[model samples]
Target chain A: MKLEKGVLLTCDPAVKQILLMLNNRQPFILQDLDEFHVVIKAELEAWVRSQLETELEKNTYNLE
Target chain B: MAMQKGASSSTSVKTAQHSLLPFLQTQSQQSLTRLYQRPSSCLSIFRLLDPLSRQLILNLLWLESPVPLSVMTAWVTTEGTRAFDDAVSILTKLHILPNPSVKLSLSPTFKASMRQAIIGGGTTASFGVPADAENKKPPSPANLDAYALERWETILHYMVSSGRGQRPREPSRGVIKLLTDSGLMSGSEAAPQITSAGFQFLLQTPHEQLWQLLLRYLVMAEERGIDLIEVLSFLFMLSTMEFGWDYSTSSLSPTQEVLMEDLRDYGLVWQRKAKSKRFSPTRLATTLTSSLPSLPTSSSSSTNTAAVASGTGATSEGFIILETNYRVYAYTNNPLQTAVLHLFVNMKSRFPNLVIGMITRDSVRRALANGITADQIISYLAAYAHPQMRKFNPLIPVTVQDQIRLWELERERVKSDSGYLYQDFQSLGDYTTLVDYARQMGILLWESPAKRCFFIREDGHNVMKQFIERRKVSGGG
Candidate 1:
């Protein structure tokens, strides 16, 4: 029997931005993860994390 | 609740009413949800059920206790045993019965209210008394037919065009607002786009669509403090009303007058003046419950509305040819119908009086995205297929229909349903009885006849309990 796997995504906006990554085929930050979905590629993730590394930013991440 | 089945009553009636009344009565108090039937869909399935079965259920629902199947069986005499068995089976499947300990009773509220509806002598006068009009001249049915079709087509055209052409005078602003609010089409929306549901509505056989829209109107009227029984009975009465005769409006209650104005929008009736003493019910009104195939072509109601009625709503049976390739060709140009086809088909071309479309993956997905269901699309296609389509060996190539379903199934890869699983029966004999009873009631989802095991829907909880109790009493082990 072949059982199909599914990921039911409920909430999280970061996945939306990373969806654009499908435009590229390689050097893809999120493509190789094999996860059903990804929040952002490492490059994109690193860029956003470093840019908003303040306590307020951390609090905002928790809020999100 | 089960009332005592009188000798005069048939057992089928007794058993059905005994089970159904309690169920309906129980749900009625909770804002009258029609049990599992959706708030929007019609109860035609229930309508199709044997009327004797319904009456029996209604009659006994007022009783304080459940009607024993034993007693009900006796009431039907020898001839009705099979029907009694079938009715009980259906009721149990619907999950209306309480545990099957062989006997018990209805939910208290269901018994009381259902009895009230069936008995019918309430001062509330829920059934509308036709208002007496002063103008006594009865017009010929021909004149009435023409006026009705004209009035109905004019309004449908308004919705179809959405003010693109000359805006015609209609019944009232309230009627327009009700159409928009029901999501049939937002009449007030600038460039009203036909919602997928609206498209489905357009493809409905003429009679069903009328009931759907009219029911929406009736619900709205009920919310505004108007009596439902009066309006509902009046609507039912309209089915019996003579098509071409003018009746007096003078005797109408305030609520009936309100409905009159609204009915004009749907072309149920026509009035020369706002408070015209004489009004005639159009073909739309008289044929409220008429069968689909009979209505459009029955020259009786095909007067002025023939153009819109003719162009799209053919009075004659249709011509549709379904190819082995899964393409469907329909002989129609009705905007409403074309919009419906667009829901499940990728239209390849259109000729003067014919439209051709292919049922494809992307087209179906787009339809699903818009909230139109796979079942609705299939039924719509089947309902209006050209007469020729019906003559196909299977009425539609099985491959295409199966493909339509497969295409839909691929979209929803995961599905979930809540149900009850029965395990660990004390003995095979005990278990088999309950399983057979459950299956007979139509609630069993899966069963192992060999293993004495089965699964059923949640609604069967009531019947399951009863079955177990009966076994305990009967010494099934």
Candidate 2:
């Protein structure tokens, strides 16, 4: 019955693991919902998205 | 891709005409009835309705008594019922059909005015009155078309040049005011910058763009204490007006006179002098309600000096060649067209009659950052693809389209929603019941049954709380 206001982010399980690692450094995650979902601070959604994008970019093979 | 393009382009045209419908629906019922009093407005609105609605109106136009709803319903085929219902609903919303009860009848004012419009007998002169023929020297249709094209293009060119740091001629003060008011541009009038909406506006066909501007003008008119009904009727009258024929200004009300000055700035009407007793509705104004192109096709009328002088001869026809390698070659020297291309293409060179560019990932991303969507850019290229490109089943090379979409998708990786996470439910039964309840309410965002937790939308939290409280009272928790 407890209530909290935050942004729920859904992504692949692999991406969730990356989010967990980033959380340890910056502490934006409010709660880890499951393997594929996490709740982050509402105000930090944009910042977290940018961080995840940059982190994922390193693992992707780019042609250009 | 071809099917998608066809579907989207058709809907865009529908939206261009129906855009006024949404505005009209927002007005008070009284105001709508007042608007329908004018035969011109009634006819214009009839033209705006979908085919089925138009049919329904025509069928009911001559009937003296209201027909039973069942009779009308019986006339529609099984597949047409949805469209029938939609037509009825639109009519009811616009107050053209006052009620949706057992009896179906057109609103009295609407019926009378519409009949007057179609049957051609009304003293109100809802259609514009013809000016006296004495000393008649009306502007030729070609000249009117050129004038409309020039005035309309000035507004567009201003918007395009705003973002590029180039200073094109600023449009009239009223035009600038309308642009800023409509959120197409931002900042002070002297240094207005085109916004994302402005970029999208540039991509619309001139017909849609004019409606967008006119709708905004309607709002501005209301703010200025001008009668909405008068303004609307005047616009509808203009749509029914014949191009190249002068309409007498003697019939205009004071409010309409003011509007005439504003409409002139947009090239909707042309007068010989500021104080001229007669004004001619240009091609732009006459085609306001029809799906026809507002401006003349530059290809068919290459002799249009203003269009040729401004190099807008390529405006309507296919002039772009997009390669699989993402190289773009546009066969136009119009600065406005080139400015629009600069929005999503990296320009390499510009010749008198051609411009070459490439749709690089960076360029597309920059457009995306400015809130110009991938679809808008793709459609613009597709719409203006070279005649040779049109021979292909799907224009604009599928690879180029897919890559542009992927670039857009790359920027939208994460999906986020603001909601409350419910955890620590008393038991599995409690979690299941709450989850089912949230699902029924259509507010469930995400749920994890194994963890005895679920997420519900922010607005549903209070309702869920009340449900749980009621359940506890009944000893279910």
Candidate 3:
């Protein structure tokens, strides 16, 4: 599904997981990406990488 | 899942809160980052936001550079500072605004997606397509509206009537399961009993009722291994679909086809035959994005149905007139309306086209016990306030509203919170700074100056921990 522009469309399972959570009524924080086993398209891969990186930073900050 | 169900006594009161905007706000950052990938979802969310939030989003949308919090606050009127801050905080919570204090700008994905929806030139077909050009007959708006109202109320009637020892047309098995799964009802499908959530569901506005059910449907669909993105896009696409027009189901994906069938049962769509290739979107489907919760002509469908079934011309504007003496004069004979009113009203008399009831302290408290809040009852009344009563400065008397709230508040004499209690401090200076930080973040639930102790919400721990970390790093630097 074309959830965002500038990202190549792929039938990635991770996208499906994201879609499920997006529709979820209750709040959830993204904790693990390993749970979503899907290939990320090259262009979108960079965005995913950055997202994980930012989350990592935030988690580390809290730990500190 | 238990949290949403609010099975716990302490959380039962707070957990019942559900709305599209708050739902979006609680989404995971990853999910939101992906959700904003679609222009339609962006626009849908933007439409759902409050007016102040909309203004804030638009202001940030067109910015060439990130604006500081001070600059943004300066743009708002002095009286609107709180609203401005609330809007920014909501945006921030949704990750739509990365940072409010440092800078304000729409998230990259939302910015692009919203821009696309407004300009409207995308092959994504996100707005929906008129798939059937060869339809022999298109459904009329009035027919579609009536069908929608009838089917929707069938579900409502099923819930209310079953509880009140009356037999109404049985709702579909899927609809029954939805109510049961959402914790709105319990018991076997044929004899489902209304739960506290069911009472709250009955009191919600039509639009909210629709969204809550639809959201539950999404979860159910996901469990069935249906693609949620396809279902969600189709749902959003329905919101944009033209009312009373036939759309071909031929082009729909397998998942969408499944959704279309479910929509038909809910009366959001009409199919002449079970295998019909074309479906006409009903008013319920078309008005999904509408901000107005009440339909002008059809909001009183309960009364209309009652009039038709009884062969009487009970003309009324779907208004509930409340007097200062706690007497309620409702201008309809709809059993469903009467059943819902019976939840919180002590009926004294009933007429062919009218029901008179008194809103007593016991009744209000009973409704509260049923998990229906006073605000919900007041809003329900305000939403259906008689046109003649609308001329009044306040639709319901202020004294009556206050009394209802006061009665409900009596139960809140003992409050409960699940949070972390902080007491030990190395020094008074350390306690002072941490307390100040917690208060500023609006996470401080309680504090005592003498003990140098404070209580904060559980979620506040991460921020507090990070704040201490930041102080250490800065001081060391």
State which candidate has the highest lDDT.
2
Candidate 3 Cα errors over 4 Å, as ranges: A1-64, B1-18, B25-34, B52-112, B294-317, B324-326, B359-369, B373-378, B391-394, B397-477
Per-residue lDDT over B1-477 for candidate 1, one digit per residue giving the tens place of the 0 to 100 score = 011222223344333332223423333323442222221111222343466555555556656667775776667868877776666555444443444348635434334434554454544333223445445566555555555655555555555445234344443566566667678775344445445566566555666566667667766876788876456545645654566666667546677787887787666877878867767777776655443331433443335254443344533455455687868787766554555466577888998778887777677777776667665666566556676676765555667767767766654432222345565566787677777888898876655555445566667777877877786787756
| DockQ, every prediction | 0.03, 0.70, 0.01
Candidate 3 lDDT over A4-50, as tens digits, reads 11211222454445533532533232212223222223343444544
What candidate 2 gets wrong by more than 4 Å, as runs, is A1-4, A53-64, B1-17, B28-30, B133-136, B297-306, B309-316, B424-430, B471-477
Local accuracy of candidate 3 as per-residue lDDT tens digits, B53-112? 888888778777888777877788988888777777888888898867787888998898
Worst lDDT run of 10 residues, candidate 2 chain B, spans B297-306
Fnat by candidate, in order: 0.00, 0.72, 0.00
Candidate number that wins on DockQ, 1 or 3: 1
Among all candidates shown, the one with the greatest TM-score: 2
A1-64, model 1: which lDDT tens digit per residue?
Answer: 0111211221124432443343343333322212332223333443433332332223322211
User: TM-score of the B chain in model 2?
Assistant: 0.90
Local lDDT at B371 for model 2: 86
- Model 1: docking quality category: incorrect
Task: Show model 1 residue runs off by greater than 4 Å.
Answer: A1-64, B1-50, B54-70, B75-172, B186-192, B289-315, B333-335, B342-352, B357-362, B410-477
Candidate 2, residue B87: the lDDT equals 86
Q: For each candidate, give its TM-score against the true structure.
A: 0.54, 0.89, 0.63
Q: Model 3, residue B87: displacement in angstroms? A: 4.4
lDDT of 2 by residue, A1-64 (tens): 5667898998878888889999988999988987778998999998888888789768766344
